[model samples]
Target: MENRINNITYDDMKVFFINKVKELKSWPYNGKNVVIAPLPEHVTVNPDKPSMFCFTEINDDYMEFRRSAFWLVSGTVVMAFMISMMSIAYLAIAVCFFYDGSFESTLFLCFFGSFFGLYVLPMAARIAFFIPHDLPVRLNRKTQKVYIASLILHGNIFRLRPELIFQEMDWKYIEGWVLHRSVGKGTPYYGLHLVENKSGDINRLQQACLYRTGAPWSTSEMEYQINNIMSTWSYCQHFMNYLPVPDETEKDKNFVFLSNNWLFKWPEAMDKASRSSG
Candidate 1:
């Protein structure tokens, strides 16, 4: 028997489409024509668009392991060398004291051991400091929408929140929503977290989300929710209108992902959202 549920009509599809459009009208990023979607599995986002979504995982596994090993070995060697040198020096000084009673030799050994342990040992430890590998978020700008994908190191797989970055950015130049994970069957909410920028500065302007099993929703579902939210709230209107004029070139170099102005400036858009919601 033909299944009634399987036989949806063209008119039904049209009605469904219209209803979806209506629901999007009240969401953030609604006014702008651009849409941001995650890259398909095995595909990646392009890198030319400023407002597109992208992601990268910072890999610290191998570097951390190697650093720990180097520190252990180097620390052991330094300790052993310092102890041996000090012991030998003290023995020689004792022998000299017994034979000719030379106070100068004993003082020299003491100073030598102190200098090597205090200064040289610390310098040796500095050699083990390794920078963690950075992940890149790739984006592609289409005529109306943006595509995004994440390029993370194989060993570093952890969830992240992108709204913090969005809060910091000059929303005037960004017209799309970064895909985010959602929670519950009701309308999905984006997860915003505070993250530190490359220069060790704390900024909350990034827009991206990572997958978390513990979260109430999956990554794909979150992206759909973000799209719905953007559609309803009209969040992209400002970005499409007032593009930011860069203040300084040197300051721009400080951030890992966002522009200097976006990272440093306080979040005005989020405040507006709060006021409107209230």
Candidate 2:
């Protein structure tokens, strides 16, 4: 068994797991078996397909970080507010006891106030924090574009924003296409949507694109339905044409090109390539 495991290549291990799932007759979660075509080789200029160059997927790690940040910020704010409110209530009840001399009423108020701060407020704040607010964006290393999709956290609440939260330096240097388009009268913020590939379609011939956003005047659900029909004819490489934001409007595009030397793990001397060349 040890020898057999050692001989199995990464590609073979993938095939092995796929075959095991097929034998069990269960649909692979998130359709992991779905095979997409290889990235296209040559660029094709097709006037018919305006959205031919855009494709989007989810970045799991970034989404997780955003969710955690939201919870921390919301939880801390709510806890602090509740504690302050309870303290104020306690003081009010004590003053009432001093004036009317109603010891039982004051004691009751103190007990209820403590319970509200300790249990009720925290539970309510947690529930509010758990509500979804942001979506996931995946950046393709070859194209500096962003893609947006609705993300369900733990199978609950749907996130909607598709903005990339990477630092300015990372955004400027990163290669990939963002999936969402900016929409506004003058300057529009980009809109992100969640998308999923269809099952058993080895060529990735089928796809389902879903957009859920709070903003009006954005692309409607029906627009997405129409857009996905066109996505079928788009080549995978076209999805990789992610030009930076300035290129979206400017004519002369000056981009920081990545070098082959920067592709792999390297020693301290090799790490200097990031600065040696543009």
Candidate 3:
């Protein structure tokens, strides 16, 4: 038995598991396998074609961060009022200098007005232009390509054209994905880390791009639930084929560290520590 087990390879193990999944497809599971819909209101996944994924709106967290509509509108109004007052003050200053026939004072006031105009105008413009916006990440499984883009909303109306944020990347660039779990303010933040196969360089994808915050579960529970869900993804299944089983040794490696605490140890933590420390 030991000799036979030693002959099995990682690819063999994956094939076994994949076949097992196929066998279980006909089994009753509260009727059938429950399909999860796209999470955010703006996201839509094609049911007929598993390869196509769509996201249309900004994240709720980002919208909330932009503040409530009342505050946003009121704050802008207040800035507008400040600008009006500044304009009136500048006009009054100009009038005073001209009436007093003080050319030197007028020159000094003009310099000061230019300085304030340069800074304040830009600040106001930024506040006015900064609105909560949506960025979409599309995955085309058939093509093995993923696109990160933004859908420009004109006057708060959704548009069809996508503003591509980055050129499409093949699965090879995003294949070695690892979830770096951390807890902040009692909430779990799963950071996506992808490694390039050729260069072995790790890229940390934006947290908002991956997780939807404000779930009811505590940090630990959420981590477990997310891990289970991620395992169902076809991409994740393919990535697993390249993973190290039980033990592997190399200077650098990619693996999921699900614990909220960095000090939390896995079953093989001691072995890994000894190997690295030695």
User: Which ranges in model 2 have alpha carbons more than 4 Å from their true place?
Assistant: 1-101, 124-136, 143-193, 201-211, 215-239, 242-278
Best of the candidates, lDDT = 3
| All candidates: TM-score | 0.18, 0.29, 0.31
C-alpha local distance difference test of each model: 0.27, 0.30, 0.31
- Give one clash count per candidate, in the order shown: 29, 17, 0
Model 2 weakest 10-residue run by lDDT: 60-69
lDDT by residue for model 3 over 9-115, one digit each (tens)? 33433343333223322111121222222221111222222210111221211100011111111333245346645755775676666545477767777776666
Give the per-residue lDDT of model 2 (tens digit) for 1-278: 23222233334433543443233221122215333212122333332353321222223111110111121123333443465556557656656654454777667766766666565555434333333333223333332322332222232122122121221112222211112223334222121211222232233211112221222243574365334323422322243343212111222221111111122232343223222322
After superposition on all C-alphas, the RMSD of every candidate to the true structure, in Å, is 21.1, 15.0, 21.6
lDDT of 2: 0.30
lDDT by residue for model 1 (1-278), tens? 43221243333322333333233221221222322232221112221222212222112110000011111112322443455455556556655654444677667656765665465444332221211112112111112121122221111112111221222222223322233322235433342111112222112123322221112245685455344333322212222223321222222221221121222222465333322312
Mark the regions of model 3 whose C-alpha exceeds 4 Å error after superposition. Answer: 1-113, 123-132, 150-165, 176-189, 193-195, 199-278
Model 3 poorest ten-residue lDDT run: 60-69
Better of 1 and 3 by TM-score: 3
lDDT agreement of model 1 with the native: 0.27
